[model samples]
Target chain A: MTAARAQEPVIVVDGVSKFYGDVLGVSDVSLRLGRGVTGLVGPNGSGKTTLMNLLAGLIRPDEGRITVLGLSPDQPERLMRRLGYCTQVDAFPAGSTGRGFVVHWLVASGVAPRQARRLADRAIARVGLLDDADRRIAGYSKGMRQRIKLAQAIAHEPDVLILDEPLGGLDPLARAEVIGVFRDLAADGCTLLVSSHILHEVDLVADTVVLMNEGYVVAEGSVRSVRAELTTHPLQVLVRCSHAGRVASQLVARDDVVELRMHADRGGFVVSSRDADRLHLDLERIMLEQGATVETIVPADEDIQAIYDYLVSGAGGS
Target chain B: MSDGRGPLLPAPSLRLRLAQAAAIARLELRHVLLSRRAASVSLLAALPLVPWVLAAIYGTPGRASLGEDLVGFSHFVDGAVLRLFLLLGCMLAFAGLVRREIENRTLHYAFLIPVRREVTMAGRWAASAAAVATIFSSSTVLALALACLPHGRPAVTAHFLHGPGLAQAAGFVAVIVLATATWGAVFLALGLLARRPVGWGLLVFVLELLRPMLPLALKRLTISWWLTGFLPLRSQVKAVVGIPAPPPSPLAAAIVLGAVLAVAALVVAWRVRRLELAYSGG
Candidate 1:
């Protein structure tokens, strides 16, 4: 999926903006998403679901153009075959069984009933819901309902899968099961765009992250690559030394160490700086000269949470 | 693949699309059958039986055979049932066909189907009409039979199956079917056009009740005018409701009703083609 994602863009949104009368939905959004699981990470009302809805053809953008798989969403009869969208809204027609919900979507999408039944069984099994597949959806637990929604979305084996909050309401066991299914789909070179508010959920599987805040993409790229490019944001680092206050005082005068705070136990220091290499060299010199025992030095901003905080706060949001 | 073109799935033929629509309708009909509103419709359809039951139990009791009462009551069911309760039942049956799904946020199941939106609407329309006709027609048959119950079993059996009573029962059944078809189409369109179609349904209901008092030109606009035309003219109804001109022939009345139904279908198709799955405001 990583090799394929670099080839070409499958979905193109060119300067698209949507508005609901006096309220702004999403404004001046553009993206060229390719293959693999590109996670859309944002806070509530940050336009994550709105962008997903736009690409899924649930609502039309008031401005600009959107093309999914080279076809406009306005032509759903054609585009829907290549794309499947699993919404966050957990709803099904009343009195429908789990198998019936999955099979109904397949048969209504022009698959023969015989094949639909087989695919429904395959999908239910893929989600590890084979045992409860025959139970009515009304009787399903929250995790089971989430699996059924995933089953229906993937039953037809579409090329582009857009899931909004796909991991929500899942227990640890079911979450592991569905994550394995997503990995398998990606292994087959399928394109997936998943959205979730759980940052760790995105960090677990997504190689590329689209960080959004207040209706705009603040940053998008591989998590590590995005972190590397945040040169302006002070990189938070932890220094575990015997004399944390003395080390912090000696290193605080350097140009690279913008701010420093002694650890609560006085055994370490937490420093914020714009440079990594120079800060590490200065810390080593201070520790060696002052006879301080340096246990460990860790760059805390090398992970997804740091990248997310930098970009979201960089977009003028806390 | 490098040119950004995704694999285009094979398009389904028209024949396959129709089959898909039938499958969707079959799935949707089961839930609709158990909806709270469908129960309300059934209760309303059977409401027409009430006044007649009281009349048979308490009105002018004598040596008069209830077979005579059944025959008389069966004759009046077409005008009364079609004019009042069946229309309301059919309206309830179809008003929630698509609108309720949108409100409940389950409409997305239909939106992503690999067929035109109109096919789905047509399939649901077919199912709703079938259910409404079946429910209301059974109510009419049962109410008419109640009228024949006072007579002995021989008289009741003879009147219903072996004589003109069968013909009368069939006549009322046909009127119920037509009313469901006409008003079902009307209410389904209103469901698509307005957020609160029941509010609009009140206006249509008022127009239907006032049909007899309006001029002939204004009367023709109401579905009840064409529906009542299918009945054999009753002098009592005509004297009170003032049927100034003779009703159209059964064939002419059907043709007019069919035309109205066609327009409703057209509006449904046109509206569905542009339909986006945006839920209404809270």
Candidate 2:
């Protein structure tokens, strides 16, 4: 984590709840986000977009309060100057060029036209869309549209950016380039709340994550910390060694190991342990004692996919 | 996130607010004046020019004198240009300002800016009013020139230079401007408040059309009655309609129209301030 993530919160949501008639949007969603990239991960209809909308002042919270950069969303004159939102809606004004889209929004935010143009060009370049910046947005591809939206959101140099599914339609190379941009921005102390369905990408880009399910945040904090707190589910590790039988025998007898199963080919074994640190130490000691040539020792259930499967999908629930 | 540097920018001044509004107006003006909707408004505005152009080419049916032609032109302006074409044109222009954006899911762009929503609404209203007024006012002028064309060059010059022709043209332009400004505000507010602003705009048009037959007190409430106070041929209008009451003084009419404009602007501001982004059925 960067030092920027250790600073005071830039966005504070206190027991916020929203409802759309009989439907629940988000319920009791409270979060404190510092300066850095925070992935907002949830399945569809999990209220991730709703929470972002509330922060962006697209909708008012029905039951609680939120503040971004110490200003209420209702105070848009002050809040919008510091906050930027790249909404998931993939629509633009008809007949607008990509550069015109960014520059017009900047000018709307009180930036002078010349400065807006310069800043728009800079931002468009940052998103790697300088070549297509002058093309009409209606002719842009889906990924190009997403990049232009990102360009407009960052054109004003806002302190906080709330991006809903910002990386949805991107190809692999563009996704990596966009992830690099996020990293660069986070390193410069900009706070970003990014929501995406690509869980592994979220794991790659975010320093912390807020996981939601059914309109409620089920877990939050750094991925490792949240994984550590899930004591009900044991951590799984895949061990590959020359002497799998010997290593399995040694690990199965350990107090930390709860379950063990040998691989079908008998070249390795999967071990479930209550304590990952202890399991790693035990594997190292056993491998040395048995003269086992261990080729790979991988944590099988510590990533975001496992966490999402365990918490959101209720897979193998104990 | 602020780096302990406090705000990177100061609170926007009133001048900045006005500049933001002007920027929005410039963008919206381009759309209103160039979009397919603009073409429709142009067609509506040009409707009055057709008969006048034909008269200049083929002459009037009875070979009417200049005085009679002027009287006929006055009626045409009051009835076709002002009552029918201007009303429909403003409806098409102003009511589409917010409604079209909402339908297109583009209103959030303006809402996300660091300016008040009222400023956004005002900017859009100003653009619509300017576009409608420019198109219809230019049409009115061309129609007047064509109506006066077949009366011979010397007589037409004397009528325009020394007679009431200049004042009449100016009155038509003033009425167009004032009517567009006031009606544009009302339609803008309706666009925010109503799900179907065209229906509401047509209802308003119906009320405006019925103003001549209403009681004096009720007539005073209609935009048409107040606009009539500026008509150069008020006596000709009165002679035909035979209404007993005198029209409101020009100053009183101006004040009433100004008051209506202010009220409509306030409604627009209030409605837009409370607006939430609900674009599902837009």
Candidate 3:
């Protein structure tokens, strides 16, 4: 799937903006996605799914244009033939067997009958549900249901697979297995846009990250770049102890400890520093010398949650 | 494959859309047959007619009589049963369609397909209509066959015993089916257009039933006007009722019903096209 073909940007969403009456889904969000996996990450309402929908040709953008594989989404004919969308919402007809459902999608994707069968089996097996393929979808667990959706999306070998929260409700093991499939898809140069609130999930699979908040693109760049922008200040390490002054006094000597705030409880103090190594060394040495036992060290270097909170609360203007 | 030219069939792919719709319809049919609720409702639908059928067979003034009075009497009974059957069938079908989709949220799978939303809708409509048609046709056949049995009333069998009479009876069945199909489309469209199609259908049904009494051209506002116009039998009899009227030409009424159904189906298509897979708050 990868080696024989030249890389091409299959999806181009330029200045795409959409307002659902009053609520905004995506605002002035623009990105050119080519082969490989791109993770769409943001807080719950951060327009990640909106951006994906825009690119998938599910929703028309009010202000900007979107092209999927060089076709407008509004023009359903040309665009949908090549696109496969897995919605964030996990739903399937209750009565269909997994194999029946997968076969239906395979046939629907325009695969030849023989090819459809082969593809359906391959996709079902790809999702690691071959044994359960004949089981009724109604009887399948949520994890199994998710895999069924995945099988449908991949059965046709779509050029671009746009998934919204595909990993939701899966156990850790299932999540890993699904993530592995996503990684394989990316490695095969199949363009994939995965929208998830889990930062580590995205961090594991995507080279690029698009961050949205309140229907606007707060940030869009390489994962490293976004991580760097999020890492403006050093992690704040709050150490709890009986002698707060003693801990603060030892921390003040090191240049690495840039900011210090005494804990309100007087039992500990919070120290901010970019260098984790120096902070840990300083804390260890100071606690040993003072014979003060450190209760806890909490490093808050704009954890994904903090970044998400900032994006959400600060989502004033798109 | 043409250079910069749009393909006749668009995204997600037509093949997938058809497959998805077929799968949905198949699942819906299975649900209709296997569901306990569906079974009970279907049983209830057929329940009320049993006593009326028994009465028509045994309660006539004389057991062996064969004459015009029996024909008139049979027409009255048959007409009432036919109307009741269609009305209940339409209501049940419409409510069933809306409730199932709303409860299960299974519509999400269909929404993912690239075909026009109407295509998916048409598939479901066809599926339901096929089921309903089968049920009604078999029931009518059974009713006709039973009417000919030895224990059946002589007047009932003697009236419809001949070939031409049987053909006319078949024609009557055909007219009833055509009318029901048009109403089915209307109801199915209503189901797609509203969240509570049955409630809305009832409200509209009551309004249509009463609207005919209003002055002049307003009578045309009711679907029943067109539907009744197509019936083989007239609602009122001149001797029994005060003012009797001739039945309208079935051809003209069918044309009108067909056109209205087409327009309603188009509206359904348009509504489905705009539909989102959101569970609620659309």
Candidate 4:
């Protein structure tokens, strides 16, 4: 496929710092983006939502500059029209049918009356809520309510979409469907910024990742690049054999095996080394030389979850 | 090229601002029109006027002095209905305008939109004004129609559009509209600025009620003081009450009310422009 359009930055933040009284909301955060999907990942209270609000023009940073679609968050009118923000707090006006509510929202956004209705229908259909479009919002389930919120956000076809915890309350099936919608929207070239504590979801949907912790952007880049920045620890080895005691002694004697734990179930012996491949080779030779039956050899750091934990907690670096 | 002046243009126009305002208004209307709470409030508002109608029908028509007294009673009843309905309408409408959004957590939903905060505030005030008028008008008409029976006074229907009464009632309606709109605006700012608005709104109500009893010019500082000054009954009771009289001209009173509204609107806009959602230690 031809390269997707590379326009000027639709959003830019420079040295943006926010504080609530004395507590830092997010400090000295800077980012520039034009399009495509970017995942904002962090534990709760890590300021992912705050940064989303800042981008949506819902809130202003006290100490820095932010421009969304070349409009200041402080001046929400011009910017709001060009962006669609699906807030974590999903709500609809009481007593209104999903169809009526969505259409009215588009009308309020300055869509022509007739066009508003059409667009509302189209958006509801897009979110797979076409069958239930005419039902009162009060009668809808939580997952359906979230879809209505999504429908309103996209009804006007805003240039940018900011979704904060969009998948928080969905069931597994609903999550898969919503994730498909997000991926499709991103693939269509909408500048999508999603914040979720669910790491696997972010890894699946985002090409770029911004990791925050304690009101700071600790890491931001391509997912692979940022994960690689983690301090690589020695690989772990677990061995279960007839001569386990002898294997443990041999592993500890090696300079690379820094930490060792021996299980009492006779299941195996666990050992950590700086070079996992080297340890694998050494263990192979030792097992052959000692004639010990080996059961399992696994590198503990091979999973993304482990990499995420290591990056977030500064486990090795700090 | 043209005397060093650029083409004369309306500065950026209020198109976007107006659009934002309309969206907010539409949201409020959708909320009030569709919600059960609004229906319940409408029922509660009409409930008080029911007793008056029953009293007018079944109470003592055979007494000698009853005819004259009934005539006088009719006028008094109409005026009281107008006054009471407007006052209650304002209190109830503004209370809901500020309180319900917070309770539902829907106010934060609006903030997520790219609309200007001030536009949202003002639009809510506008929508609430429209909704309150619809509720109060129905009550006033019902009360007036009941009051017009037996006296052959042609009822309260035609009277609404007549000579001095029309201008006076219009003025009354205008004051009610402005007072409630201003009240909603101020409370909306409080709602957006603070985590809790109902507590603050009630405190403001108490402050306004005690304003006239204060020792200084602080009476002018209260919204109720200006609102009551515009009440036709205040002019009637001025001599006997011995209250510190407001300026003599009704026009001056109107201007002061207008000023209060303008200032409150500006404050709401300013507060909304700077609003920062700061729940998580930010």
- Residues B1-282, model 2: lDDT tens digits: 456423433477899889878988888898888899889999999998999888889985448877788888877877788878999898888887876887789888889988889888888888888888999999999999998899888888998899888998898898899889988888887888899887888888887776667778887767877887887776666525534567678899889988999999899988888887845210
Best by DockQ: 2
Kindly report which residue stretches of model 1 are placed more than 4 angstroms away from their true locations once superposed.
A1-6, A236-299, A314-318, B1-10, B51-75, B144-171, B229-240, B276-282
| Candidate 4: stretches off by over 4 Å | A1-10, A234-304, B1-13, B34-44, B47-55, B58-85, B153-175, B186-247, B278-282
**Residue-wise lDDT of candidate 4 within A1-318, one digit each (tens)?**
223335566678899987777877899999886677888888878888888877776567888999876777666556666678888875666677899878876665556678878889988998899999999999999999889898888776666788888888788888888889888777766678888767788777887877788888887777655654654655556677778777788889999889988888755788888766688889899888888987777655543455557767667531
- Evaluated at residue A35, the lDDT of candidate 4 is 71
Per-residue lDDT of model 3, residues B54-84, tens digit only: 8656655445433333345345333444445
DockQ of model 4 vs. true complex = 0.21
Ranked candidates (TM-score, high to low): 2, 1, 3, 4
- Residue B189 error for model 4, in Å? 5.0
lDDT of 1 at B94: 82
Q: Native-vs-model 4 lDDT?
A: 0.67
**CA lDDT of each prediction against the hidden true structure:** 0.78, 0.85, 0.65, 0.67
TM-score of 4: 0.75
lDDT of 1 by residue, A150-213 (tens): 8888887778888888889998877878888888988766688988766787788887988887
Model 3, residue A271: distance off in Å is 13
Q: List the residue pairs that clash in candidate 4.
A: A19-B282, A20-B282, A234-A273
For model 2, state the Cα shift of residue A104 in Å: 1.4
TM-score of the second chain for every model:
0.84, 0.90, 0.72, 0.68
Top candidate (lDDT): 2
